[model samples]
Target: MFRRRASVVLLALLLAGPVIASPPAIDPAARNPPPTIALSHFDRFELQPVTLAPGLETHKGNVVARQYLDVDVGERVPRLIEPRNATPVQGEPRTLLIQPEVADIRFITGGKRVLFGGFAGSSWALVKLRLVDKATGEVVAEPQFLQHANSIAAGYSLGAADKLMLARLADMVASYLKTNFDAPVGSAVAAAAPPMD
Candidate 1:
């Protein structure tokens, strides 16, 4: 009986050896987090010409609205991004491209706006934008923005509210870029520090 018990214990120990020697399973992502991108990673930003959706070109006033958005956003984004040139330099690694497209648009003319006001209907514009890395051809981010012009008071003065909506859309895009463009603390410090030489 004593010999049989000793053999059973030895067999159990041998069976458990592999389990004890092997490392526990751990997620690789937990050990090393994925990389995150910040606006500081880019040295230049390019805003592409704003475009209208395929079917929207036939709609009345949409072409003009597209032009307005193109100018408005084009002006505002550069002020916030600090780079106006769309041309990529040779061997440039840190350039970002911003593409804005008008997905949908509803335009209420001034005459209709004055006569019907909010009863006629509200004017609205939907814009879809993407931020892409010029070097790697990777899309960094894609976001959509919507702006509306609704005026309950019907009058000549408020007829141009639709135009104001375009301006508001531009503001929204600028604000979004500004909020996300924060440089990492380390990078900011390094940039501020003078040359060691």
Candidate 2:
């Protein structure tokens, strides 16, 4: 009786070993390409292209400063068909919360322009921006940052200028991030592989 019980237990163990040792099962829902990252609207607001009087001009001023996104992925990362631009490795997806933003705007009046000798004031707004991880600047997979617009100097137009300027600044920053750095938005984190032993 003892020998029979041992044989049955040994058979069960052998059957279970391979199943547990195999790679984690990929989710059926993830066979399709992942959705584009669903970027959110700005959570807060503030003036950009700001400067101090004469101390710094538009070209030398900081264009923007604001905060957005503090994300935490609560579930398993379904297997993802990484974007064409994404780099692949056998590792887990990181806990990421991208603060996608445009920054560093300098708004100042040019020395002086001719407003019938009264001088047409020219407002010069130069922008520089980036995508910060808010979590760590040292991480390699961190989003790539680029600066698109520069010295959009316009004191000539008198209507909706601020909004338009802001819009341009925002768009350039977004476009920059999209073109460089990080994986495609909404890509999934991978699971840890089972031990080879």
lDDT of 2 by residue, 1-197 (tens): 99986775565434322222222244523321222332222221111222222323233222222211001000111112123215443554333233332322222222221111112222223233322233454222322121122222333432223334444434433343333333444221221122111
Q: Write the per-residue lDDT of candidate 1 for residues 2-119, one digit (tens) a residue.
A: 9986775565434322222112233322211111466667878888999998987876567878988889887788776665344455675588888888877776666556544554
Give TM per candidate: 0.64, 0.29
Quick one: RMSD of model 2? 30.8
Q: Which stretches of candidate 1 lie over 4 Å from their true place?
A: 1-36, 83-91, 114-119, 151-156, 183-197
* Model 2: CA > 4 A from native: 1-120, 134-136, 139-156, 181-197
Q: Whose TM-score is greatest here?
A: 1
Clashing residue pairs in all predictions, respectively, total 0, 10
lDDT of each: 0.62, 0.28
